[model samples]
Target chain A: MSAVKQFIPLFDRILVSRAVAAAKTKGGIMLPESSQKKLNEGVVVSCGPGAVDADGDVIPVSVSVGDKVLLPEYGGTKLNLDDEEYLLIRDSEILGKFVKVTSE
Target chain B: MSAVKQFIPLFDRILVSRAVAAAKTKGGIMLPESSQKKLNEGVVVSCGPGAVDADGDVIPVSVSVGDKVLLPEYGGTKLNLDDEEYLLIRDSEILGKFVKVTSE
Candidate 1:
């Protein structure tokens, strides 16, 4: 009961929550656990109400909440809730927004 | 042998190929068949090699080769090939690029 949950995303939708795998295996030898699952790189937390245009107007969503997106190992709609497992997705399925690793 | 296939995508990635769901049911009463299994809306054909920046350079990949993308019901990695059943995804998971539905 602690997978982490606090979504919002409604309009443009986007409440990701993955990002947990850092170093499961790379030189180990035990790459079984379902092939390591994979697909982890999110953070946004919430976003939406920005895709309408055509005359309806809206189109905004550029990234804000926390920004760190980069999801696409598969895709949105996974929701679990209390058990934890968010994804939601739709900020155009966000493909880029992770630029803050600078620390030389 | 006609599920439609012709991908290309590579770097920034973007080779959708779904779009094939017009109407299954809504007023009929048949909403079973895996709940219609909705998640279509693609076209982009090919793209990639972009997104490198930070210093590496590149960072190109706004979209090309047909365009008309808009996916994210779950996400990429679901290929099949000759048998059909694509969903490669990546181009930042392409969340928007469809603006040519003029009619009158």
Candidate 2:
């Protein structure tokens, strides 16, 4: 019933929604969109069944849906649906998971 | 005893040696080094123990040493040792395995 459920990833693949553009400077000065370096941050939307082993067994991936992860600058297939863009990256392409730090 | 044994990759990392430059035209005219586009082909020298799970079990990688593979155009840690340069890429960065085809 949701756009997120429209597609299913396969073979250790992960669907991610990219975060908003960076480059919010200290002052009110706004630089052109092309001049700013894009960050590799995103939130996982969906995941595949995981990679297969030598014996044909599926090994589960480390990250899951809703997990915020750091993506590589390059690679990953681009997907466009319903006027929205998404990225399909492999499980190994995920640099690291971003965990929120709450005030203790 | 070989230079390949000098470094051992960790996690899903893989050590690769880039293939030679392309652009050797059929006419045998040599193009300048700067004009040639580099292919993402390489031989796997070594690989890490593979990714771990929540329970901390090591999942064996799909590829092995001595396999010819397609490398990504970017996002690899470069390593230079004893004159030869190598790359440290993740297992997922490998596009696919390259197999030689012979005339039957």
Top candidate (TM-score): 2
- Compute each candidate's TM-score over C-alphas: 0.26, 0.50
Assess candidate 2 and give its lDDT. Answer: 0.78
* Winning model by lDDT: 2
Give me candidate 2's interface root-mean-square deviation: 16.1
Q: Point out the worst 10-residue segment of candidate 1 chain B by lDDT.
A: B1-10
Task: Report the C-alpha lDDT of model 1 over A1-104, residue by residue, as the tens digit.
Answer: 66754556667777777776544565765555665454556687778765665566575665678876667666688888788787887765565554433333
DockQ of each: 0.01, 0.02
lDDT by residue (tens digit), candidate 2, A5-83:
2555655888899986656667868878886755689999878778876554798989999999999889897766456
Q: After best superposition, candidate 2 residue A44: deviation in angstroms?
A: 25
TM-scores of chain A across candidates: 0.33, 0.81
The alpha-carbon lDDT assigned to residue A31 of candidate 2 equals 70
